[model samples]
Target chain A: MSVKHALLALLEQEPMYGYQLRAEFEQRTGTTWPLNVGQVYTTLSRLERDGLAQGGGEDTEGHVIYRITDAGRDEVATWFTTPVARTQPPRDELAIKLALAVTVPGVDVATVIQQQRSATMAALQDYTRLKRQATGTARAELAWSLVLDSLVFAAEAEVRWLDHCEARLRRAAAELDVQNSRLTDGTSSVKREFRRSTGETHADRTRR
Target chain B: MTAVLQLTDVVRVHGEAPHEVQALRGVSFAAYAGELVAVMGPSGSGKSTLLTIAGGLDQPTSGAVTVEGVDLARLGQPERARMRRTSIGYVFQGFNLIPALTAAENVALPRELDGVAPRQARAEARQALEEVGIPHLADRFPDDMSGGQQQRVAIARAVVAERRLILADEPTGALDTETGEEILRLLRARCDAGAAGVLVTHEARHAAWADRVVFLRDGVVVDETGADRAETLTEPAAR
Candidate 1:
């Protein structure tokens, strides 16, 4: 996710041109997150401008090589030690869909949840299959497997969330059924008062 | 490859007149040798109905259900029961292991019921249990083993006599995530080893283990696609 830090870390190993940096990054990460040539140049230029990297003399092929500055090394060190922050979670589309589905009257919430669950499960299977195909002992394989594992874990969490949503919706429907039956048991007015007092809170909980 | 199990224009209607429920409305499906096809649908969408018809546990109304090119309807009740015992394997969500029997005994029960020698049935059961990675649990009773282990035994029972058509209904429903995946892997492996499998599951991830997915809705085959495309089909479209 931090392309700058990744580029900086790669540059720390040796002086390299834009293309070499891109190749090295992809090689190390197993090309899971490919780095484009233009993006590499842009990041390199930013690094130079920010005093984190300096343009070195051209190589024999007239390609401009870049070397990491002391500041870049410090940044890479810090990035490696810091844990990723989770307080401000990324806006997940599936989460947003379910949240909207619960409150929207016309939406088929069960279908929405089931569809998303299927998608996440497919992704999880892809990850698992990919993991099985990757049989390497290099550090790149290790790095790539870690990245793949993160995706697998995220997809697994998504599936569990979808299952929870389905269960909650079923519970809500059952409760609604129970309320409807009570309404017909000659306690309509009393039941209406209870619903008015507590239904709002229940609705809020369901939305969450 | 020839389909080991095929349902042609299968229609299964329950009850009569006003109370009749068309659980499967002209549904046609097939599972070829060495292929695992997952059947997915919401509850009461005829998923179980489809699986039962395919396994010959239930007959379809005004349609054909064939296993290994043999029509199930043409067979008498006794022969149909024999077919179920020797050629078809069914795994349920409940594990469905006989608590009174040991794991090996439960697995061997199907083969023994088909008139296999007790010694031979037990040997085949042990081999099946070993394939499921739980050979040591063979002597353990259903109540003595963990849920995952019980499910493995159930799977062993399903495949004990080398049944070519395996039908599973939410086989991984009761297990933890890791164990569920393990069970799916076993099913996938079985299909790879020349068995035809039909898995009825609500979970898309489990279906990913299959070669193809058949989506059902309102007792109809809504969409049939490769497992890889399942995610794209479910993606939210632009309104």
Candidate 2:
């Protein structure tokens, strides 16, 4: 999802200040991809370097603005011509945690979720301390603050989800185990098993 | 195998009266099953327009376009649209997702429209979303996703419809280097899944993604190259 064209896509309409661009981007997509002012400006510079855009000149506040060029418009049109299909969010740590939860016999899903919860909670604590301790007015420090905020929120969200997952996994353990055995052995016959439960012959089931 | 799409001297005109524009002119091309072809051209060269006609979403003003062994001009508009909904999966540039719908809902829409049960449709959507690696996002709306994430969700939606032919205008047009590469890889994976896809792009980088690339010039097919192809073509190399 780390596509610079996201910013470029917004720039296709008209020139905008970096701060304005960031705000518009967040508002338009509901902030699915959050960006700091620095990240926005850095991406703008790269786009300018790539000849996809040119600076639109600064306003009274010294904030530089940008607009998509003919080349950039061409790029945008090209961008629109193809269908974007991202099926998978890259490699998520959660995927690995869940995969092993079932494959490793006796490996407790609840325990794994708890382990992640505690680790993430600890990390969130450190982020909190670092965010509070920072007092400098440096631009870099302010930028770090935004990143830290994102990290803190994400860590907190994960811990919350892990707790919910632990409860669900525990409650479903017995039933999941029966299903799990059939799934693992690859012997769950859809027709035979369904007929056995319904007490109907295969021919009768097919007729119905 | 039947040619999935065959365009013979097709033309598409837009606008009327005081002004007129020809998006396509005497363009001819063919796509076979199991083929992944790239459509390449400069802006306004009409590659996207041509793809829409080939996919049966737009009608040609003159000449002929035969899709799925049926003459497109022969089919009624409603029938053509149904054919498109069932046979063609379009990956658009803007990711045109339904913001109000959950990721799974978006993926299951075509099926629901085709009258599949909501529960059954959702089950299929879940599988498709899982195939694309965002099954967890099934409950989230488009607003809650990243650009790459939204695109993945869109891809799952496109494929989940169970369409056999894909007409992608620029599957990676909006992403950075890494994300674009990921998109191209996924599109290629679609081809490996026994579905044929036609990709249109201005970048030569994606020329590798197609079994063939049909370069367009002034709305005409100029050159056709296979995968692993390199040619001077007297045109500047695509960046």
Candidate 3:
């Protein structure tokens, strides 16, 4: 998410050309977040404009290398020590979909939740398989495994949320049934009505 | 590689007429040697029904289930029971170890039941306990061991006779997260050691250890995906 800081941190190691920087970033991150060479060059130019990095003279091979400036080193140090801000969480499309599905009419909310749950489950499985395959002792493997685990945790959370949504919807429907029966009978026996109609308690409904 | 277990258009129904519950509706599946396939679904989605039919503990109302190329429904009840003891291994959530039996005896029970000599059965059981990384627990009774240790003993029982097909239903339902992971690792190891395994689980994390995942809903196969393509299936669509 913080490509600028990541590039700065990488530059602190040694001077690198655009291609070399991209390759090194990918190697360390296990290609989980691939860096385009063009993106690297563009960032390098911006760092030069901001005086955070300076381009050294071309080598004998005609490749221009960039080195971190004092400003870039200080920025990288701050980035490492500072906690990542959560005040403005990134927009999650699944969260948005579920939120809208509950309020939107004729949306078939159950189907929406089920589809998203299936997708998230598939992704979780993929992450676990990748984790198993990444058994190398290299530092890159460790980094990649950590990244994959975060994704797995996120997907697992999404699936659990979907299940919660389904249970909530079922409860809402059961409550609506109780409200209807109460209005007809002029009796406030919501629990008894729910049981009479569904032949099961709220706990049974949620367990199903 | 050949499939150690195959279900072809299997259909199972409980009760009759208006009260009939169609537990599995024309579901087909296969688990190959050296592969772990996970079956996942909500409750009443036929996961347990599928497992029971595959293990030949129950018969299908329609279609066929084959283990090692032999149709299960074709065999008599006694023959099917024998096949279950010799070719199929089942693990349940309860650990299911006999209270009076030691870990090694529990693991060796299946072999001994199949008329195998007691000494040979005990030797196989010790080897299995060693494979599960708990040989020292062989002499300990189930009550003396931890939940994880008991599960390991159950796994040893499952794989003791070199059974090619292992069916597990919520095998880690009773253990903590770390212990559940250890159990999954053991199941994965068994599959890697050239056995076919089918794991029925509600948790996606448990299903993640599988090579292929099959999703069931309303007693029908809804989706199937290989582990590598899971990301593409879950990725958000273009806004």
Best by DockQ: 3
Q: Where is model 2 more than 4 Å wrong at Cα?
A: A1-208, B16-18, B227-239
State the weakest 10-residue window (summed lDDT) of model 3 chain B: B227-236
- Greater-TM-score candidate between 1 and 3: 3
Candidate number with the higher DockQ (1 or 3): 3
lDDT of 1 by residue, A67-147 (tens): 999998999899999998889989887778778888989998877876776566667767767765665878888777777
Which regions of candidate 3 are displaced past 4 Å?
A48-71, A102-104, A174-208, B1-34, B44-46, B56-66, B69-77, B98-103, B133-150, B174-179, B218-221, B226-239
Top of the candidates by lDDT: 3
Q: How does residue A11 of candidate 2 score in lDDT?
A: 84
Instruction: Pull out the clashing pairs in model 1.
Output: none
Task: Report the first chain's TM-score for all candidates.
Answer: 0.84, 0.51, 0.84
* Each prediction's whole-model lDDT (CA): 0.85, 0.75, 0.88
Candidate 1 displacement at residue A136 in angstroms? 6.4
TM-score of chain B of 3: 0.94
Q: After superposition, how far is residue B82 of candidate 2 from its true place, in Å?
A: 1.3
The CA lDDT at B209 in model 1 is: 73
- Give the alpha carbon lDDT tens digit for every residue of B13-125 in model 1: 99998799999999988777777888877788899999988888888988999999899999999999999999999999999999999999999998988899999999999
Please give the lDDT score at residue A15 for candidate 3: 89
How far in Å is the alpha carbon of A89 misplaced in model 3? 2.6
Error of 2 at B65 (Å): 2.0
